[model samples]
Target: MTHRALLAATAIALAGTTAAFADAHTDSPFSITTIEYGERYLASTLIGESVHVADTEIMPGVALAAGTVDEWDDIGEIGDLIVGVDGTLQAVVLDIGGFLGIGERQVAIDWSALRPVYEEDNLEEYFLGLNVTQEQLEAAPELERTDADG
Candidate 1:
């Protein structure tokens, strides 16, 4: 019922499913061995898109809202058009910042604040299209962004 509880359930369910799917690994070069999930959010470097750890690593100074939880059932997908969907916590939003390799920052995100993207037909494109900017992300009420002087 609570946000934290929902996140816990989502994490447990995702971990269990991932464990079960682990044995199906193939010898292909693209085969993934392990997919580690974290609790922090990352700001996408590119606007209008979802950020992935595969593309970037977590940055410093960004903090994830730890322990927040949500239900997997409540976690809906943008549709059947995306590569990732069910079993993923709806709260795992990306936190991207900076310019072209300039002051970029990233994080895994709290898995309790995500809202399933409603359009899966173009999930990647849709996520990549998100207009979130570094200033907006840094100024996010949920985040505590400060300069070195702070």
Candidate 2:
């Protein structure tokens, strides 16, 4: 075969192979209607809820001004969240016994013990109630640290 004709045939073969590979990975054939429904339902049910630890109210990433509730003025900000084995929110981890971010400990408070403050039908705030105080929080058990290797 002529050199030009041979080169043209090789080029066509390469193009066909490349097109086939591209077609295989392009898009999925399955429909995502159920996924969309689940996402919307979960978001509506779980989002927009707020949690109050001591005098501070929190909504995930948003942190409001820290204040004192009566004489319990030593409560620190929330550091993490604790979930139960049943996939429900169990407690809020609060940073306590610290001074200027030093010598702090995280302690868990019962989720049910937190007073849910609402506005209209939506959850707007939370209160730890008078039962909890800064002194008690400082004396509470410290959270155990776990390594990622576990």
Candidate 3:
């Protein structure tokens, strides 16, 4: 099947599962209320955390702040998110360069490359340990999502 068809099928499957969950009235541990609470708690703990890049060569978890070329000290923001066919996070599209979206480039880095920082079981930040600088991402290939059959 085509990628677009596959994506649509995945979406439909997820919607059906969500509808079933919504219709469920059981008092099981996996109830919708419990799931919603977990989601809300996670969001409250992780929303404004910073995402940095680490140098694994020096030490295992040594990281540095990541941002645009102009605002090197500022925290990098997630521009978009890419998911796999199984609804798993695959990559994160980040804005690396340019000012106010003028000459910025959207680059997708694999989800595995990022390391989540947690303090006392609450997410506080994230670090990307690809050992590459902002210049590398600026010069790296851009990611484009298209439905056209190749």
Q: Could you estimate the TM-score for every candidate?
A: 0.24, 0.43, 0.47
lDDT (0-100) at residue 112 of candidate 1? 32
| CA lDDT for candidate 3 | 0.54
What is the per-residue lDDT of model 1 for residues 55-83, given as tens digits with 9 covering 90 to 100? 12323223323321111111111211111
Q: What is the C-alpha local distance difference test score of each model? A: 0.36, 0.53, 0.54
| For every candidate, C-alpha RMSD to the true structure in Å | 20.3, 13.5, 13.9
Order by lDDT, highest first: 3, 2, 1
Compose the digit string of candidate 2's lDDT tens values, residues 17-90: 99999998887877445733212223233332332335444232232344433334435655666766797877
- Indicate the worst ten consecutive residues by lDDT in candidate 3: 66-75
Question: Model 1 clash tally?
Answer: 30
Candidate 1 at 150: error in angstroms?
A: 25
Candidate 2 Cα misplacement greater than 4 A, ranges: 1-74, 116-130
Better of 1 and 3 by lDDT: 3
The TM-score of predicted model 1 comes to 0.24
